[model samples]
Target: MHVPDGFINTPVSVAAGVAAAAAVAVSLRGARRELDERTAPLAGLVAAFIFAVQMLNFPVAAGTSGHLLGGALAAILVGPYTGVLCVSVVLLMQGILFADGGLTALGVNISVMGVVTVVTAYAIFRGLLKVLPPGRRTVTAAAFAGALLSVPAAATAFTGIYALGGTTDVAIGKVFTAMVGVHVLIGIGEAAITAATVGAVIAVRPDLVHGARGLAAPLKLRVDGRLVDAPAAAAPVPAAARSTRKVWATGLVTALVLAGFVSFYASASPDGLEKVAADKGIDQKAEEHAAAGSPLADYSVKDVDDARLSGGLAGVIGVGATVAVGSGIFWTVRRRRTDEPAAAEPSAA
Candidate 1:
């Protein structure tokens, strides 16, 4: 959920800001290991895709709707460290450009949405994959379950944060119940989206999906009366080796279709957090977004009378900007990894 300003007090918000800063710092270092020529490019696409899908909010309850949190999906498609950075990038863009999430509450949103969801979802996903059959189906299933749990986990984190720093005097227990309850329904939608997206990529390019990397089962052969593992095949051609130009073109086109075309049909209802806040008085002290006056505030272009055209243009701009920013960060991380000296080969003697 995009926490607005004044929901949390100054001290707690500042503390969360420090925590968010530390989390990003750690993610940057961890990403060095996660980013590769293949994964680095895919990481940017994952961020752009997340941004696009989040625009399509599905109805969850009578008045509440839910959208892709992207942590679980990103972590499954890429890696957890890079996933954190991905969601953070989307949050940054939405805050600064769209004026959706508040600038003051950026840290809170990152802490609850970015850090908490990625860590929890990745842990559950890895754990399940370890026990389940090593196949694409199992990996996809784990992704679904991981995504289902992550939403409620994030809601729980927010409840705790609010308990400590909530501006209003609402009952902590009631808040927790409502938040987790509504988000549980939202989690179902999250699970379906995560599973479908991860499954689709794994079907075509399992190599690009970090969680599915080692899940491919080895082929077995029957030699005489005994079964033996077949010799592993040589490494497949890299995406860059075959056709970087084509892949980039296809990815950009898909992103444009989703954001520029499909987003026009997204639900207009308030999302899970907004509904809960309004019902539970969490927004009693909520302050206006600093960028409320921005041209793109509320995901509409300034002075655009046509609702469809205004929202469509905003979505396209958002997708383009998110991809650009995400690719730049990931490319930097990948370049840094490449620049580091390789360890000396072991002595043959």
Candidate 2:
């Protein structure tokens, strides 16, 4: 959920800002191990895809809708550290460009939506992957469960933050109950989206999916009444050489369709967090977004009379901006990793 301004006080927001900065710093280092030639490109696509799917909010309850949180999906498709950065990039873009999330609450949104969700989902996913059969299906299942749990976990975290620095005098227990309850429903939707997306990629290019790495169970055959492992095949052509090009092409096209076309059909209802906050009076002190005057505020282009066109253009712009920013970050991380060895050799020499 995009936490707006006035929901959390200044002190808590600043604390969250520090936490978010630390998380990004850690992710930048961790991502070096996660990003390589094959995965570096996909990382950008993952961010853009998350941005696109997030626009298509599905109905969860009478008045509440939910969208893809993308932590588990990104972590599963790429890696946990990179996933945090991916979601953070989307949050930053949405805040500054689309005014979807508040600028003052940027750190809160990043901590809750990016850091909390990625860490929780990745932990559960790794745990499950250790016990389950080493295959794409198991990884997909784990991704689904991880994503489902992460949403509620983030909700609980936000509830705690509100308890500490809430602007209003609402009962903490009620806030917890309401926030957790609605988010649980939202979590189911999140899980399905994560599973389907991860599963699709795993089916096509398991080699490219970071979480699916090392998951290929060797094929065994009986020869002369004895079981023997099949010979490993040559590394199939690089993902870029054989399939990744097509996959990336298809993924980018799909992102465009979802953001530019399908989003128009998405329900106009308030999302889960928004509905909950309003109904429970949690947003009684909610302040207007600083970028409310931005041309793309509220996901609509300024002076665009056509509701469909305005929203479509905004969605397209968001997807493009997210991809550009995400790719730039991932590329820098990848380059840094490459540079480390050269720098180290100079010292050794």
Candidate 3:
């Protein structure tokens, strides 16, 4: 959830900020191992896709809606470290450009929505993959389960944080109950989206999906009447399939359509956190976003009379900006991975 300003006290907010910064720093290092020439660009596309899908909030309850948190989806598509970075990028863009999440609470949002979700979901996803039968179906199923649980996990984390630093004096039990209960319904939507997206990617380019890596059963060879595990033959790739260009172009187009047009039909009700805050009086101390005056504030373009057009343009801009920033970050990380060897070697022998 996008925690706005004034919800958490200054000290806790700062603590959360430190925690989020630490998480991002660790992820940057871990991402070096995960990012390669092919995956680096796909990582950026994944971020843009998450940004687009987040705009299409589906109705969860009478007054509450939910959207893709993207933790499990990103982790399954790319890797856990990169997934955290992806969500963080989206949150940052939304905060500074769209005035959606509060700048002061950026750390809180990243901790709950980015770090917690990614860690929880990836752990569960990998754990499931360990026990379940190896197959694309199992991978998708595990992704669904991981995504389903991640939302409530995030809610629980937020509840704990609020218990420590909540601005208003609300019953902690009621807040927790309401937050978890509604988010359970929201989790169903998250599960479906994560599963479907993961399934689709696995179907097209399983090679590109980090979670699906090594999913193919090893080649079995019969030697001396005993079947032995053998190295799987490298499958020949056509000149076209080798490049990530097709996948990247397709994903970008899909993101553009979802944000630019499909988001218009998304539910208008407040999301899970907003609804809970309003209902429990937790929002009493909520402050206005610092970027409320920005041209793209509130996901609408300034001076744009047409509601549909304004929102569409804002969404498109958000997708473009997120992709650009995410790609730059990932490209830098990938370069670090490549440069490590040279830096380690002695120069001028």
Highest lDDT: which candidate? 3
lDDT of 3 at 22: 97
Which residue pairs clash within candidate 2?
none
Clashing pairs in 1: none
Cα lDDT tens digits for candidate 1, 142-237: 999999999999999999999999999999998999999999999999999999988887777676788988678776899998989999669866
Candidate 3 structure quality by residue, lDDT tens digits, 1-349: 7899999999999999999999999999999999988999999999999999999999988978999999989888989999999999999999999988889899999999998889999999999999999999999999999999999999999999999999999999999999999989999999999999999988888888899888966658999999999975588664334889989999999999999999999999999999999988999999999999999998999999999999999999999999999999999999999999999999896
Per-candidate TM equals 0.92, 0.94, 0.94
| Model 3, backbone clash pairs (residues 3+ apart or across chains), number | 0
Writing each residue's lDDT as its tens digit, candidate 2 over 45-88 gives: 99999999999999988988988888888888889999999999
What lDDT does the true structure give each of the candidates?
A: 0.89, 0.90, 0.93
Q: Any runs in candidate 3 off by more than 4 Å, and if so which?
A: 218-241
Candidate 1 vs candidate 3, TM-score winner: 3
Name the 10 consecutive residues with the lowest summed lDDT in model 1: 238-247
